[model samples]
Target: MFELSRRNFLSQGAAGVSTAMLTSLTRGDAPVSEKKYAVVDEVAFRGQTRRLKLMQGDRYMAALIFPTDYPTHFRLKPELYPVCTPSGVPVTDTHQYCFIHHQSIMTGHGKVHVDGTDHAVDFYRQLPYPNTERIDKFHKTHNLFQMGPSGIQKIVKADWKVTDQIQLRLILDWQLRDKESSGGKSVISEQRRYKLFQRGPYTIIDQFTQLSPHSQSLTLKADRHSLMGVRVNDLIDPDDGGMMHDSEKRKNPDGNYWDISGNRKAPRWIDCTGRIGNQTAGIALFSHPNNTRNEFYSRGWGLMILSPTLGHDVRVTKDKPLQFAARFVAHDGALAGKTADELSDEFAAVDYRKMFETEK
Candidate 1:
């Protein structure tokens, strides 16, 4: 059994910085010194998918990757994986033994079309399948990440810009284009925002994606593959030892119920937890207001996502992008000691629009 580390990572850095740099380099009144500053390091991957690691006080906090395959130009999945506890135990799991389709911590899926070809891709998995609704990548979408006052951001030359910054909460903003979707060319644009932060031992991630058709229109067919989610470690999966709770106060006995809620009156959130290492660790997924789809999808054996596009076919043009938004919270720990309603109350208090202006 592994003993969990409860060290406070935010307290380990050097303190007392120059009044000038503090004001010039950080967000709000966060007295950041040289030691507490976050850093990013890019490393090599075996293929086109490059990896970038984020650090604070020089300790590993998270990693982002661009999962791209060359020969097929499909499966261009982007992810933030292996999120760790203060003591360094990876709280999230990937690369599983059973469902093999779970190699992601936070990933996105949408079927893009051009000339009647099916480009609905799932960058999350790398396998041949009966689950054949999978393919990956964009014609010219390049992903990038960097460290700043807003936190870590992912950029794609000019087509995509994502900022994962910290204010009262960590806020993520993404602005991108539908590169080469219409007859093999960039035609549409999308903007997204996410806010995440940690409270006690829980980490909360909230996201919103907006669309603009520019001059051409984009279509999103109703399917079970969309939104960001996680695949829990086997130790905490229902088939192994975990339990799942939904807003209806109902429990899913196991993972076979992945997205069962999507087929019915979906709940507001789902909570899953079990013994991680030697401590009781888990994840609770929350759905917020204004989402396009009324249902949420959840599976046992550790998989959860917000299927905002389920059964709702969408046609996006420059004038009609605000018709939808997929917003959810991925929180670490099973309320630890609080109730789902209490957690929901806390999530409700976050307002990412009140962000700080980046230092010039």
Candidate 2:
């Protein structure tokens, strides 16, 4: 059987794992038969809620938490929480008083136009009109925090498959709140998928998102908050000695990351590396070249986002949906720029269609 040692895995990184796997398949060699990791359901908080945990051997590596508590779960969005390094230190955070809506890793849109309507919906904030405007301008870091939004993501159907990777497939209804009626209106149908696998010293998370109008046409307006987002641990935030780097070789040393170089050019990847206790860990968010390619939202305050519709409006119909994919490489150290580029190139070369095609 093919076996990879921890030392070799750490030395070569995830790219080497791909090469090894492909070589093993090509040479008809024995596979890595040992099941080193697994995805399982975990009950927590006195069994009030359940979550999906990615377990490496007997340790926790990551989790998909469905928040059911007050306020945070009001938005009805599940969060990827407690993303940990190989050594078992969490690199992600959630439910911070500063930004209660923020998740370790999440997805949402700010301004969504249904059937080309004049009013834009703020799914990102999940807040209604006036509240959304109020919260946008309110920046007192120490003041009382309010529930950002009320828009709900209703899970219509969900399925999970485990192979070399653990994949979670969800069909969700993006709904808007109605004052007179309950359960909101389903405006958009979303197909969101997450695949988690181990690649050498990195825990790779590949996200695939597809959105279509429920029954009418929909337009995703160019809003700053629309797309996939991640929030690193506060201890790793740039404000707290962490470092943010992008494909343009720009680093955020001063709290101001509005350089817009990578955002405007749509860099292949952006990352943040920092020390937690005695371990140095990092997370690199990679954009596929085949994506719509728009501005990236990078912040020094522990937030990184991929915005595909930030520059222009994207229209979608029931038949024609808007789709995109991204890869999150969470490793136990800073990744070199060359390695980041290589990983980005490898992700760009993936046959996403075949990998995510509807199984027959």
Model 1: lDDT to the true structure: 0.47
Q: Which candidate achieves the best lDDT against the true structure?
A: 2
Tens digits of per-residue lDDT, candidate 2, 1-360, equal: 999764344334433433443455478643333446677887765656668887766556688876442443343567788786554556777756576667788888877888746566666654532332344345666211244335666666767887777788888888876666567778888888888877666778888888888888988888667688788877677887889888888786322233345444556688988876446778888888667664577777788888677667888886668878888888777789999998888888876654445642
How much is 6 displaced in model 2, in angstroms? 33
Candidate 2 clash pair list: 126-149, 126-150, 127-149
- Alpha carbon lDDT of residue 193, candidate 1? 43
**What is candidate 1's lDDT per residue for 71-141, written digit by digit as tens?**
33223445556554333334456656665545545644444332344344332334333332433443334
Name the 10 consecutive residues with the lowest summed lDDT in model 2: 253-262
lDDT of each: 0.47, 0.70
The positional error of residue 9 in candidate 2, measured at the CA in angstroms, is: 32
**Candidate 2 regions off by >4 Å?**
1-35, 43-48, 67-75, 116-118, 126-149, 253-264, 354-357
Error of 2 at 98 (Å): 3.0
